[model samples]
Target: MKMVFRWYGTGNDTVTLKQIKQIPGVEGIVWALHDMPAGEEWPMDKILTYKEQADAYGLHLEVVESVNVHEDIKLGLPSRDAYIDNYKKTIEKLATVGVKTICYNFMPVFDWVRTELFKELEDGSTALFYEKAKVDSMDPGELVNRIANELDFTMPGWEPERLKLLAPLFEQYKQVSAEDLWRNLQYFLEQIIPTAERHGIQMAIHPDDPPWPIFGLPRIINSRESIRRLLQLVDSPCNGVTLCSGSLGANPDNDIVAMVHEFKGRIPFAHIRNVRVYDNGDFIETSHRTSDGTVDIAGIVRAYHETGFTGYARPDHGRHIWDEPCRPGYGLYDRALGIMYLWGVWDSMRAGEVAKRA
Candidate 1:
């Protein structure tokens, strides 16, 4: 696994590139132009600037977390063609910067949903929490306000610009079902995968966080079977999955190890994180240690190793440990700690393999 870190960018993030470089085994940054809104083609100069910054710190800018597929594209509106055209242009520019993978999601209203950003854990360190009851009972508008008010920085998916159109977006989505989403997603893949193939960039779709529909919104890209169906949509290497552990792990039914083996060559990026789920259906992000959460992170890494995965992987989200006031899930201390834990697991496996050969 070629380990990477998620750096929001200069000024937008509390963690600096200097700090990221200090983390052992991290060779690249998973980044994007967060300031740029959806559907707009990213400027070449801006893309170059990020490239320059990563180069300065000896970090490769090969994996972009998202290009933020526009709502129009997900909604399958007539204007989607224009946005998709722009997406193709953005893909071309990112390819210029040597970006190997572009991670985007097709979740309709929100990229990911959490009821609490700092839900205190038993150990006193806090982490992103998802309360199923709260999500089911709360109004979508109210949930937006609660989440927005808590964040010092604009959360990626909960952008004010997009949330402003929430009512109409919800109304529009009311007309869209799971089948409709699958068809629209297929349309998107068919349109863009050829361009991605030509540019040598893997277009990875991140699975829906919580792996379930929320606020009456249809979520299709969550389950293992659904993922298999997704791969069949375009049937090209460029069309792929991000293989996020925490997102798909919420379902518990998703055999992540099986996915590692099954989707072997197609996954170009992996988000390795842990979450502890309760019988009540609430979950809180935990340290990357396998014991700390329900996810079999070590097993997942083992599977990756066994499959000869050399793709870009990152410690996805982390707890608010050491009183470090950082992005809700994207903190320095815990994520760095997570990286070490991952390395320990992976390296031990390597050592075991060498011993067997000997």
Candidate 2:
């Protein structure tokens, strides 16, 4: 596994590239042009600016966390063709800057959701939390307000521009079912995968945040079976998965390790993190340690090792520790710690391999 860190870019993030480089084994940053709206072509100058900054710190800015998909594309609207054209252009621009992977998601309305951003754990560290009962009963407006009020930075999925069109977007999806969503995703992959293959960039689709349908939204990338179906959609190496553990682990039924082993060649990126699930079907993000949460971090690492995975991997959501006051889940302290934890596992696995060779 090639370890990378998620750096939200200078000024936009509290963590600096200098700090990220200090983390042992982290060789790259998973980044994107966060300021650019979806369906717009990313400026080449801006892309080079980020590349220069990361290079200054001796880090690669190759894997972007997301290139946000416009709602038009997900809805399969007539205007989607125009937006998709913009997306293809952006892909070409990224390829020019040596980007190896672009992680995007097809979930409509929201990218990820949590009822509380800083739900305090018993240990005093806080994490992104989702209360199932509260979310189930939440008024959309109230939920939006709660999320908007808590975040200091503009949350990726809850952009104000997109929220303004929420009602209409929901209306657009009123007749759209799970099957329709799948068809729309397939349509999207068909248009973009060939371009991605030509550019030598893999389009890694991130799974739905909770790996389940939320608030009547039809989430397609939630399970291993769904992932298999997705691979069949484009049937190309360029069409791949990000293999996020925190997202898929929310659903207890997802066998993440097995999926890693099964989809080895097709997985070009991974977001490895842990979450503690409650009895009531709620969950909160936790440290990368196996004992700290439900997801088996060590087992997942071993599976990746077994598969000889040389793809880019990064630590996902982390607790807000040391009163650092960083992005809700993208804090530097815990994520840096998570990297060391992952590296320890990878190192041990490599040492074992060396010993066996001897």
lDDT of each: 0.93, 0.91
Give a tens-digit lDDT track for model 2, residues 1-358: 8889988887889998888888898899988888888888899999999999998988888898778999989988899999999999999989988999999999989999899999899889999999999878887778888888877776789888898888888888887899999999999999999899999999999999988877888999999999999999989999999999999999888899999999989999999999999899999999999999999999999999999999999999999999988999989999989988998999999999999999
Give the number of the best model, judged by lDDT. 1
TM-score for each candidate, following the candidate numbering: 0.99, 0.99
lDDT: worst 10-residue window of model 2: 149-158
Q: Report the C-alpha lDDT of model 1 over 1-358, residue by residue, as the tens digit.
A: 9999999988889999999999999999999999889999999999999999999999999999889999988888899999999999999999988999999999998999999999998999999999999999999999898999988875789888999999999999999999999999999999999999999999999999979999999999998899999999999989889999999999888899999999999899999999998888889899898898899999999999999999999999999988897989999999999999999999999999999999
Please list the residue runs of candidate 2 whose C-alpha ends up more than 4 Å from where it truly belongs after superposition.
none
Task: Give the clashing pairs for model 2.
Answer: none
lDDT of 2: 0.91
